[model samples]
Target chain A: MKKIESIVLAADLAGTAVFALEGAIVAMRHGLDLLGVMVLSFVVALGGGVIRDLLIGATPPNAVRDWRYPVLAFVTGLLTFVFHDTARALPFMPIMTLDAAGLALFAVAGAQKALDYRIGPFIATLMGTVTGVGGGVVRDILLARVPMVLAADIYASAAFVGAVVLVAGRRFGLSPMLAALLGGGACFALRILAVMHGWQLPKATPW
Target chain B: MKKIESIVLAADLAGTAVFALEGAIVAMRHGLDLLGVMVLSFVVALGGGVIRDLLIGATPPNAVRDWRYPVLAFVTGLLTFVFHDTARALPFMPIMTLDAAGLALFAVAGAQKALDYRIGPFIATLMGTVTGVGGGVVRDILLARVPMVLAADIYASAAFVGAVVLVAGRRFGLSPMLAALLGGGACFALRILAVMHGWQLPKATPW
Candidate 1:
């Protein structure tokens, strides 16, 4: 149980860091100064989870409770600023890979939490997707740009797959850890492969 | 009671429009094109409340619940783009005044909701201020600029005052609407005056 909890925590931190890095990069792209970068990092790391917690009546929320989220965000922001040129020079593929891992974990955790609250699977799956993409959506909107996930990408779709897997695993009586691992792994692998192959969901059209 | 509810709803819509306008202006200042302007407007109008709701356990949130918010935002955004030059030429003072009203209303409403959920006074007040400034903070950050309220401005302070007044009024057995009105008025008046006189709280020493 302790080991499993630690894995969850580690995944949460990893998610926070990747989201923070994404915010910092967007800030840089927009020519914001260091303060702007740090603030965006904080938003990207904690914004969605904060929202999720609030909706679920989680008081003070994780961001305010676990000082680690803010600290990690701040550190990520500072590091990005310090190594602006070098960080930016790294190819986008590696960054996307890291992001995929974070996305998978968040999807699994979000759905799991919703299930713990006894919410129906449909809402749970939706919440999972929201939790996974909330920070990035907020980050992109703040930067006044189109959110990357909403564009032609498998980002949201990959998260949905993970959420469905988790729900299905539970019905099949899989252990929690095993289910989470399978769900998370599927999400991560799907996202990475989708990015590599330029896969995208077709945009829905009313016309 | 029904009449009063209508009034509150109207106030919300008006606030949405005013905030949307403020967003468009900021986008113009940043030299954003049409799509950027629309996106900024959406963020500035709904970002704060969305964050506040998420924190307080409001599901699907106002952004999703009240389709009017986004629709109003889009309309004002298009209007701003179509009449960019005229909108730019308008005096800043009136807009600032309207924004002050919106801030006051949102702050009081946010705090009241938090208090209704049985959150403590300090946290309630924090939520009030968050609801008031969240959108603009997101807006400015996206524009690669410092948040207006945090910048030697009396913005959040005014919201804090409003929140406290509401709490105090409730403690004294005042009606909810009455307390909210008093608090909201205090916030609006103070913010307007602060903007006029360039008032601001002392910034804490930069660690």
Candidate 2:
């Protein structure tokens, strides 16, 4: 149990760091001030988990109640702000790879948490997808852009698939750790392929 | 107790209806499809309460668990969609008045709910302001517009003041009903004055 908890914590923190970097980069591109960059990074790193926890009746969400998460987010934000130009110059492929990793980790984490809270399978799946995409949706909204989840990409779809896999695997008696690995791996692979192929959801037929 | 509950329910439903109308109008202006219109109306009507409920450890969110809220939102959306031209042509003052009423009711209701949940006065006040503005923030985000709360107006300020008044009044031994009435009335009056006078918060100094 201790080992599993440790692994989950490590994965969740790593995901937070990567998403914070992604949010900071977008904030910089939009020419937001230092404070704005920090806000965006914090929101992108923790917003999804907060939403998921709140829905599951976790009052004073871990993002708010636990000191470690915000510390990690703010530190990541500061580093990104200080190294904005260097981060911006990094190759797009590496950034996408990191983003995919974050997405997978969040999706699995969200689904597992929902299950732990005894939420129904359907709601758990939806919660997982929200955990994967909620932060990015918030980041985009702050920047006055339509949420990418609703507008384009195969992003939320990947998260949904991963969540379903995790929940189904658990029902079939797989260990939590094994289910997480399988779900995260599937999400990561799917996101990478979608990016490479320029895949997107079909839009509403032009109003 | 039942009387208070009934009053809260009526006010909440009224607020939902008005915000749904506001959201539908914005969707029509943006030329979104029917699906988009319904989505926006639903979000705008229920987003605030969802946020409030989640923060206070209310699971599943009343917005999702309760049938009446969504029904009211969808009905309002459909009406707006069908009478798009007529709604669009209506004078701005009446719409603004209706919006102010919703904002006031949400502010008081949120603060009251937070108090019921035994939250701190300061946090309750903040929650009230969130409940007042949260739906509109979601609506603006869906339209790719900067949230009006952050960008301009005395909108959140009015809600904050009203919430503070309610919390303080209760602390001083006022009944919940009386506090709500005073708080909501203050918010409504302040919002109307701000609208009429074009009052706004000063923009942050550049960078």
Candidate 3:
């Protein structure tokens, strides 16, 4: 049990860090000042989990009660604030890979949390997809951009698939760790593939 | 006690209806189809309360658990979808008045709920402001506009003022009904005045 907890914690923290970085990058792209960058990073890093926890009646969300996550997010934001230009100059593939990783971890974590709260599997899967995509949605909204999930490549779809996989694995008696690995791997791979192939949801015809 | 409850309920329902109409109008302006219109109306009507409920550990957010809110929102959306052209042609004053009323009701309702949960006055005030402005924020973001609260006029300020008034009234032993009335009236008046005068928040100097 301790080992599983540790693994989950590690994954959650890693995902938070990566999402914060992505948020910081977006803030820089928009030429937001220091405060805006940090705010964006913090929201992107923890917004999804907070939303999930709130929906599940987990008050004082882990993101809020657990100091470590905010500390990590703020630190990452500060670093990004200081080195945004350098980070932007780095190859794009690494950033994309990090984002994919964050998506997978958040999806698995959200589903697992919902299951722990004894929510129905369907709601759990939806929660997981929300957890994976909610932060990015908030970030994009704050930046005055249409959420990429609604318009871009198969982002929410990957999260939905991963969440369903996790829920199915749990129903079939797979260990939590194994389920997470399978689900996260699926999300990551699907997102990467979608990016590679330029896959996209059908756009509504302009009136 | 029942009277207060009824009053709150009435105000909440009215706010929901107005927000749904506003959301539908925005959707039509953007040329969204039926599904998009319905989605926006739902989000704009219920999003603020849902956020408040989640933050305060109110499970199954009243917006989602209670069938009435969704029904009302969807009905408004349908009506708007069918008569969008006519609605758009109507003079803007009635719409603005409805919006001001919503801002007032939502602000008071949010603060009252927070107080019911025994939250600190400061947090309650913040929650009230969030509840008042949140749905509109979501609407603007979905429409790919910068949130009016962050970029535009004295929108959030009016909410904040009303929230503070409620909190102070409560602190001074005012009845909940009276406080709500006072707060809501203040918000409605201030918002109307702001609109009439074209009041705006000072913009940050462009970098």
Candidate 4:
């Protein structure tokens, strides 16, 4: 139990860092103030988990209950605000890989949490995907872009697959850590491959 | 107890109808399919309550549990989808009045529910306002418009006031029915008056 708890916290914090950087950079690009940058950073980092928790009836969402999350998010935001050019200059491949890893961890951990709440497997899978993609969706909407997950990318689809695998592993008696690793690995791999191959959903052909 | 439940349900359904109509029209303007219209309609109508319930740890939210709510929302959407022009031709004043009443009921009922969950008063007021405007905000985001609540409008402000009144009345031992009437009346009056007088939040001056 301790191992599982630590693993989840680690995943959450790591994911928070990745998204916070992206959110802060976007805020700077939009010409928002420091406060706006911090707020968007926090929202991008933890909005998904909060939404997932609410759906599963986990009140006082972790983002609010734990000081570490907001602190890390704001600190990351402040740093990004101060060095926006550097953050923007981050190499695309590395950030993309980190983003994929974050997505995988969030999916696996979120599915596990949903199962702990005794939700049905199907909905739990959805919860996992939501945990992975919800924050980014909100950020995109705030920026007035079509949510990336709703766009051509296979991002949420990868999360969905990871969630399914995690749920299935648990149903088949796999240990939590093992299941998480397998699920997360699958998601990470799929996202990377999708990016490398430029895989995307088929667009509706112009009539 | 039964009285309270029915009253809340009435408010929920009534608000759902008003929001569903608004969502349907927006979807139509975007040229969404029938399915898209229905889905957006459901989201707009029930999203606020769903978000409120999640924050208060109400699992499997009432919107999901009560068939009546979704059924009514979808039916309204379907009718709007078919008779869109007629719905669009609705007199402005009547629709605006109905929208205000719906906002009032949602604010009062949502705050009461938050109080029932024993959330702090300040947060409970926020929950009530979220219940009044969260769905519309989401709808706007999907439509790529700045959320009206975050824009220059007295809408969410009125909801906040209504929620505060409701919570305060309950704290002072007001009867549930009386508290509901007092809070709802205040919200309705404020929103209508603000609309009539073109009240808005101050805008920033351009340099």
Off by over 4 Å in 3: B1-42, B52-57, B63-137, B144-207
Could you give the DockQ of candidate 4?
0.14
**Candidate 1 residues A91-138, lDDT tens each?**
887888888888888888888887887878777887777778888787
Q: Model 1 misses residue B19 by how many Å? A: 9.3
Ranking by lDDT: 2, 3, 4, 1
Note the Cα lDDT for every prediction shown: 0.82, 0.85, 0.85, 0.84
CA displacement after TM-score superposition, residue A172 of candidate 2 (Å): 3.9
- For model 2 the local lDDT of residue B155 reads 92
Residue-level lDDT of model 1, residues B1-207, one tens digit each, is: 999999999998898889999899889888899999999999999999987877766767789898889999989988988998899898988888998999998899888987887666666776788888889887877876546554447777788899889988988999999999999999999999888887655321221
* Highest TM-score scorer: 2
> How much RMSD separates candidate 1 from the native structure?
8.2
Tens digits of per-residue lDDT, candidate 2, B30-109, equal 76655457657878888888888877766778774555787789889888877777777878999899999999999998
Q: So what's the TM-score on candidate 2?
A: 0.64
Estimate the TM-score of every prediction.
0.60, 0.64, 0.63, 0.62
Off by over 4 Å in 4: A1-8, A202-207, B1-42, B52-60, B63-137, B146-207
Better of 3 and 4 by TM-score: 3
Residue-wise C-alpha lDDT for candidate 4, range B1-207, written one tens digit per residue: 998788777777777898899778777676555655665687788888888987787886766555577778888888887887687788989888999998998888899999999999889999999998888887777777788789777999999999999989998999977988999999999999999999998878885
User: Which 10 residues in a row give candidate 1 chain B its minimum summed lDDT?
Assistant: B198-207
What is the lDDT, from 0 to 100, of the residue A59 in candidate 1? 57
**Model 2, which residues run further than 4 Å from truth?**
B1-42, B52-60, B64-137, B146-207
Docking class of 2: incorrect
Better model by TM-score: candidate 2 vs candidate 3: 2
